[model samples]
Target: MLQAHEADIFRPDVTVLAPQEAVPARRERFATRLSPQDLERRAWKRRVNTIHVNTDVVVKAVARFDQMLADLADDVEGQCLVVPAPSGAGKSHLLARLQMRPSLVPFRDEVGPVRPLVFIKAPSPCTLKTLGLALYVALTDLELSATLKEHDIWRRVRHQMHAQLVSVVMVDEFHHALRGRTGDERRALVETLKNLVIPDPNDPLRPPGAEMRPISLVLSGMPWLRRVLKEDFQLLRRCIFMPIRPLGHSAACVKKATKFLELIEPRLGFPAPSGLSEHDMVQRMLKASAGYTGRMMHLVKKAAFRAIRSGAPSISQLDHLAFVFDEIFELGPHRNPFRVPDISTCPKLKEIEFDKLTRLMGTAQADIDPDDA
Candidate 1:
């Protein structure tokens, strides 16, 4: 289970509106409109809410979806697919983007049925039962009952699903069930995947004469998932592994860094933004992030209040690096003598001025060339 502290601690969920023409008024009820701040203090929520800012990652996410379609197009026999990346790699962000994006086409037009995208996170306190519950919930309002015949439940859901074309069921954090959990939990999880991504759904449970819906279960998690799967009996063989490893950020991401900075401003209770240049913002961010998602998120967050307070239209490269260094998650635990319980509220030394970072940091100009000090 996710601790309360972990919930919305890193990011907030955001809603982006597509062009009005693209959305129908009634269907638009599902729309989430994000304010500027959602990307600031609650950027982690954005992990489940925001659009993918980084294009390369977006393409990869889409590509992964396409791969899922292709694999299941012929045979929906594969075990869940895994998208694994390192801690700072932004796996959740990518997953969230995919979750929020609307269908490229409608669920149906004049056609008989179309596939709908069904995305879900595996319940942390998840089990085979919980997995069934998730699938059940996604399909309809049915109560979770072990006694409910699997095929019977599917028959009902399958009928519902026929109204839509492909239902891509995305399960994030597959590794949680795979590693370090109890054996029963693992087995339960495996069974859940089997029942969910069953090869065919028409004739009932998997045997020679059975038919199944070609549901795609994309499971994502930390990089260790690949290794974790190796130890499992049938899982490693059935699933195709998609490494969610971080690609070095592109010049394009840094090119207009101001967009990200402004995107993060509202999260920190910042006022509306004014004039800002993209070049400087991107440059500063690139330096601070050194190209890691977790750190990048932090950098965006830390700069919010500062950028707002200064009335600067854009966060300067200097400011970006300073915040990134100060707030972003380091590759490992951070250690610095200047660090305090809360840098914002740390008591000023007797000789130092609050506004003068130099005296606050107890360093001379030569010793601290950076603006962060």
Candidate 2:
């Protein structure tokens, strides 16, 4: 089995694990004060064991992904699947599940290991050389010297993908390829990706009449990635676009979002009902989360933990959510949507304030630097 590097760019964002068997144990430890280890274990269990909610958007995106894989089985030349969404819209979570599909699992045979799917994030300052290295790392455990020439690294990546029978290459945060780069650099990046889906015949590695095994590409990033693809007609034509829409204020959207929270509440292990699906609570949640699924889940998780630490039986009241929201965003009573008397009167932000969230969480966002090679 080939192990991916620990760096963010070379590793999958999430790992989907099979459901674990329930362990038989003595009960009645509720009175005991929970230690840090216990708290973390509870959080981990909630994350891994939560039921997967399939909204209309998720069902369609998954169906499209399956179709992409099915086409490969028929020896169809690889096509691109582009999933563009706002930050914290659960795009990475969706990609993670797709990567772990039974059919795409890595396997080995008499020849060697065959990886049906390779997932890697595009590195920040994504030069061709850096992108190649990211692919190489995800494809194999072997360490390659960073001093290798750009073309040389890409040649090796192409050869390895072919040899390993890689059917799909998922590049998460692909918009990194265009950020703060020159027009020429963007063009080069776009062309390189296009060539992956439809191999360039002029390449020295491909003999005039030899069969070229094309690898399908999955490019996922923020909505800006769509504009980038549009700039290059060839790449745009090859792509199947899927967007993960955020939870909105519409009646249907609110109802769906409320139901989603209801599903998650049971998984939090609270003894009492939280009434997360109530119209008032759901509306306040929508504002606090900026209608982003990821942000909403993050808020819920934090509130659950706060309740646990404070010896509350459940995340049962609006105050529980309000306290955590204020703690997370450093907002005053009036500014916190959850605390406000009229949530409708509160000003809405276009997106979740992820920078503040990250600071509160005490984790630096990983942007793989090319120079770190």
Candidate 3:
């Protein structure tokens, strides 16, 4: 080999190497604190990172609902989709996920961004005026200073929706319209919604060169929403009901739980002292969650935080999760599924029935109302 030049050998721009490699950035974990606000924010943010266990039922339901939405986009006469479920059954989560689909992507023209899907929550004690105001704020991102008449608000709502080319309007907690309202009021509310979907013959909102297509409605609420819809046959006829049931103790449920545990284990930032995928463990988890996916996530998050705070390198089923149920959720000793020996035969598991209506209405309808409101 030729001898290197003196200038090159003694170059001042030589890069120095360290003996140890640089550490990679780690995912931010929840701070070990008791602040309610911090915990709530962390919990909400963690929702995005949590594993979404899609059982067959969820897949089929999503496919069917998506197909309906696609059909509505191309049709002149818009239809309605009613998603009814119990509390903590992941209805909001499902709708949120659905809103992210490419189908809901905003359309752009020479003017600016035109959002196709308008998602709004029905205000508490929802009336036609409140509902219209909610939609107005969601569409225009502005509040009304002057109190406008219900008719004026609705007219503006329709015009804005048409101008913006909104294809679907998903209203969450739609059952609020029925809550603490008279029968006539409920009927009037339903009529207002109907009018929005299909404008009156002499509607003033049909401006020159305005798109005449109807805007589809996607309403999600508790099971009582079905009962509310039953009051108006016309409204019920326009809707396609899609029921979201809670996860029960079945082979499919077990499989989903196992898959979820497997996916989440790595992301938990700590190892599990025992296998979380075992049959008994899965059953116990189901019981603890009361067969609800949202509750299951809540339990898991609480347990994970407990493990992190205790300076544990791994989560222990006996030490961490058992204590979490007993302390955090305040389950009685006899009713604590995690602490119990036989989860399959646990009395609390038996109490976790699919019929949430029983709690709401006191008795199950022998024949569910045909209107299914």
Best-fitting candidate, measured by TM-score? 2
Name model 1 segments beyond 4 Å from true.
1-51, 55-57, 76-80, 99-115, 141-166, 178-180, 195-210, 231-235, 246-290, 305-310, 316-373
- 1 or 3, greater by lDDT: 3
Can you rank all candidates by lDDT, best first? 2, 3, 1
Model 3 steric clash pairs = 226-372, 226-373, 227-373, 230-373
Candidate 1 C-alpha lDDT tens digits along 1-373: 6688877564457455477854785567876776675444355433323323554555776776666666665775644667775444456566666665555233556865454666666664555555556666765656656677545555555455545554566766655554346766676556545555665344453343334655556677655556445645555666766664332336665443555554544443334442233454344344433344444554454454456445555544445434444443332212211233233333222211111322122212111113322
Clashes of each: 25, 0, 4
Q: What ranges in model 3 sit over 4 Å off?
A: 1-50, 204-209, 267-269, 318-320, 323-328, 349-373
The candidate, 1 or 3, that scores higher on TM-score is 3
Off by over 4 Å in 2: 1-51, 205-210, 316-320, 355-373
Against the hidden true structure, what lDDT does model 1 obtain?
A: 0.50
Which pairs clash inside model 2? Answer: none
Please name the candidate that would achieve the greatest lDDT relative to the true structure: 2
- Tens-place lDDT per residue, model 2, 1-373, is 5555546445566554444522222223335678886887567556634546676767887888898888876653678999887666667767876786789989999999999999987887677778889889999977578899877887788788778888899988787776677777778777777777777778664434545767788988767777567767877888998888777899888988888888887877767888888888899888887787767777787787777766666785465788887777776777788878998888775344554664354332333234321
Superior candidate under TM-score, 1 versus 2 = 2
